[model samples]
Target chain A: MTDLNNQPQQPQKEQPGDQPKKSELVEKIQQLGQSNVAQAPDSNIHVLPIIGQVEGHMQLPPQNKTTKYEHLIPQLVAIEQNPKIEGLIVLLNTVGGDVEAGLAISEMIASLSKPTASIVLGGGHSIGVPIAVSTNHSFITETATMTIHPIRMTGLVIGVPQTFEYMDKMQDRVVNFVTQHSNIDEDKFKELMFAKGNLTRDIGTNVVGQDAVDYGLIDAVGGVKEAMEKLNEEIDKRKPDEDEQVIQ
Target chain B: MVLYTPLSEVDIFPADQTAYDSTVITTYNQTPVKAFKLENGSYQIVQVLSTDPSIYLHPDYQPGMQFNA
Candidate 1:
């Protein structure tokens, strides 16, 4: 790499007579062949995309596309401490995974002092619902969908009364989180979760775009443009308060 | 321990591992990206995992563009 750097300089110096008319544009064109694109200042609103399956404590098989919680947890911490970042945008397109991990992420986003927004694209199913609502404001693209469903254990189960009780307790956590963060009430959300005939052989409603907003699950039925505008507005709203604190 | 998803268990956990090994998450010019390993030992950009929206607009960083390993 250092040799390549020297090579470019060497050509300019040695062929100064022959290439005297080699314009800066020509130089740029030559450099463009390489991977050296000039960079701009970092964005104040950092994006955290929750794509594919949200993998938690158990590592999904290698072939499965996963958004690892370990990577995200640290990133969230960095976002909190980074003075350069003023806002967060959680871009969600996930078929939700572990309950605990999803809740952990949702909690983290909800607690962040900086302005935060989430945009649900494709499908923000199951646990993704909580995460989508966790932000200060949320958006869902017109074609996007959100699956509201009850939690279920996949591995071996004892199949006892206590097991059902335990599952209900876990379900309550997700229910509580989504309802608390968004505008949907518990009864309505449960109705959607347990609704039948919507999904073939499944018991959930796949709420699309405007339906999500109508149910009060998401703030609006818009995409990136609206999300950016809302985030900037919230950022501006908090800026004055932060300046006051700095003065104090 | 509970899975809260509309997707089946099989879809979430695939049987094959080789398919996943072909791609890796790495940093290019300070921006983190997921790239596919080419047969010639170089990697091709599959996704740019950066917060800077501008990074996505750069022609050089677009998907299918190759960079040296």
Candidate 2:
């Protein structure tokens, strides 16, 4: 320590209270630099966008846009544990990349204790179907479409009878997850998964907004207005239960 | 430039107005009014308020039936 703080102790004035504002400015600037994703803590609602493709254990090439599983899992934990965060809004616009990675995200969203909602915009293709149905309520914009198809993988594969069985088991995991969380029937979901001729040379059905609702895959055909309103309502509904717990 | 519905009438400017040439209005009240920079001085509505949590297409438009898989 400097002997008796030999520095000049000239002016004695209350420290200005502007430090918080200065830090806030820095935070604002940092937020501005981020792309697509943002969080508005004031409303206690965090917005998470699953865009491009969901990247798995192997990181995708720099050219490919991906939502990494590792990043999102910890984020989901924060949203659940955060006292200020009252709800979650998942915005999905993915071509559906890695099956395991997408399923991990879906499981996290489905398990959140707070009010959760999802709105599929554009194309929530492939594994995105499971994610779209992971929330308590799901919305699909009129223009958005979700493709339901069996799971497929890239890279080398072993040519054994067990390989086919392993693939079938993986497909079942996805199917069960979707049907269990969503209102869609098992048969209906399977039908969509295996349907042919929908996509040129691909086997699956392209389900649009209202059709998604009709098939019980999504809860409503609406936009931000509806999704936010419904989520707010759910948050309000949860308040009393929290109070009841406090009383006990 | 078209400042879409309801938000067009809002006279209040967002704090981020100075950052971008264009104003991003959103339909969701909780979602902040985000702004984007434009090449020219005049700001356009790059983001619709309701579309802040959007993916795929912009809020106002939807892709055709032949969507990329």
Candidate 3:
């Protein structure tokens, strides 16, 4: 007996209006709290993929010029400054690049306080040798190969006595650094650099992952897992004591 | 045939060796310079300097002029 259809229609509550009001309130709250919130932190571990030639002084040959020192240096510095980044894993798949550039990069890596590990995949050759050995610990895939060679100069050969002297000094710098960082001795490295009977065109030794390990150039033969594990171990070693009181 | 003398033997600088700077000029003729005399009586070429003052010779070449070039 109630005429439902004839009943006065109650004012429909606008659900859409409530949603917009709620969104606006949320937006205002976010704006008010934005200044108080700290910036998002960096990751705990940074994995930098260094592919192609490590462009230093020499321009990489055509078809292999992806990575360069200019790009790598800033990234490394950023990683160094980031407090959350406890360690670094450099994934190297380079044929090598400019000597001074590679050396500079390697020196930076060697000097980092943070634990660092490098994994050489594909092939790490020429100047790549220094980078491979720069990290605290190094790993190379079983299929990976590293070419150890004497420092070479491209372009014109003045053949002047001074030019030869410069070459010698530069080569000596590279050799000393490599010998100091790696397990290979200076004499053996020089032999490898000047090895006349092995390679067809170049004078160098090609060491596979295992061979590199045996020569003491690389720490072990492994892949991504081993590299990460080593990096974690380094991080764990450097972890600050939670019980210690901060002087600041 | 050219005869070469060690920088040390020629006494080009001085016997005392302190007063003399021992600085020698060099050219780019590929001739070896004997800086020091060996026990075997053979002179060892230390370096060859450049003919031009702008160019410095390597430490491994002889300093004096040779008849070969």
- TM-score winner: 1
The lDDT values for all models are: 0.83, 0.72, 0.67
Give the interface RMSD values of the models in order.
6.8, 21.8, 34.3
What candidate 1 gets wrong by more than 4 Å, as runs, is A1-41, A61-63, A241-248, B1-14, B28-30, B36-44, B58-61, B64-69
Candidate 3 regions off by >4 Å? A1-42, A57-63, A243-248, B1-69
Ranking by DockQ: 1, 2, 3
Chain A superposition TM-score, candidate 1: 0.82
Q: What RMSD, rounded to one decimal, does every model reach?
A: 6.6, 15.6, 27.0
Tens-place lDDT per residue, model 3, A106-188, is: 89888888998999999888888888888889899999998888877655577779998998998998888888888989888
| Chain A TM-score relative to the true structure, per candidate | 0.82, 0.81, 0.77
Residue range A1-248, candidate 2, lDDT tens digits? 01112433436444676576566456544543322233332346778889898888764443456777776787788778878778889999999988899999999999999999999999899989999899999999999999888887655578899999999999999999999998999999999888889888989899999999999999999988899999999988877676567885
Instruction: Judge candidate 2 at residue A160 and give its lDDT.
Output: 95
Quality of model 3 by C-alpha lDDT = 0.67
Candidate no. 3 TM-score: 0.62
Model 3, B1-69: lDDT tens per residue? Answer: 554643222234224433232322222233222233434544433333111111122211223212221
True contacts kept of 3: 0.00
